[model samples]
Target: MLATMSTFELIDEASDLGQAVIKSNVYQHYLLAKKELQADPDAQERIRKFNQLKDQYDEVQRFGRYHPDYDKVSTDIRKIKREVDLTETVSVFKKAERDLEALLNEVSEIIARAVSESIKVPTGNPFFDNMSCSGGCSSGGGCGCS
Candidate 1:
């Protein structure tokens, strides 16, 4: 069975990548600050600062990837892929297909509203409204979110 993704699914996936990039960059800055802190003459104070930075970095890492809710959704999607007979459940599939379509429409509308309100959608350059993928890398692995 072939799985299809909607444009909004792509958008959400892209947004996930965008958030990951931000988190990774912050973590890198954190590591750098940590190293700088380590060399300070006040050893105990520096040690405390290092642990605090480390905890914040670790918390962001956990928030970005190791969440229980994400694990559950991943598991559910996998299970559905393996067990559901797409041909046998046309109505169910069709209903879900419509739901996804509706969801995508809603997402687009939200973005339009944000744009109209002069709110910047933080995902990256807005050029994806017309173009295609260009594989690139960031020193901080920001996924370029473009």
Candidate 2:
């Protein structure tokens, strides 16, 4: 019963943390930017056009045929890609995605470091903590050589 209660408490705390993340300004902006990206028809069309051109090029490569218009298609694809990249909605959405990704990465790293620290195994010198010996040491055991 005690173990179960503790588990529930931990879950509740995690849920609260998740709620806090969702309420953060960064997360809110990410949601808004994602909505803007979804609602922009011009941005969607540009992305679709780029995909179609890419698929056509892939098909040509798959059939091993020398496509006369390959260069033209590639150029068009690049142009559409550039235009889509320059679109405000797309750019905002990408920035928001990167921001959210960075936040998540930081959270993950913090969690990982905390967990690792708690369960850390001693590796002799903390400063030169390499798991394996490089075997390049002039004196066998001095430089992490077992």
Model 2: how far residue 107 lies from native, Å? 0.8
lDDT string for model 1 (1-146, tens) is 55567876977877985566446644445445445444544544534555555555555557756664555555554444443333233334344444444444445546556568444333333343222222342424344534
lDDT of 1 at 48: 52
lDDT of 1 at 93: 39
Q: Write the per-residue lDDT of candidate 2 for residues 1-146, one digit (tens) a residue.
A: 45788898989988987898799888999999999999999999998888888888786666453677767776777898899999999999988877776666556546656677443333333344334423443465765654
Where in model 1 is the C-alpha error above 4 Å?
1-14, 17-88, 117-146
Models, CA RMSD each: 23.7, 9.4
Candidate with maximal TM-score: 2
Candidate of highest lDDT? 2
Residue pairs in collision within model 1: none
lDDT of each: 0.47, 0.74
**What is the clash tally of candidate 2?**
0
Error of 1 at 140 (Å): 52
* Poorest stretch of ten by lDDT in candidate 2: 121-130
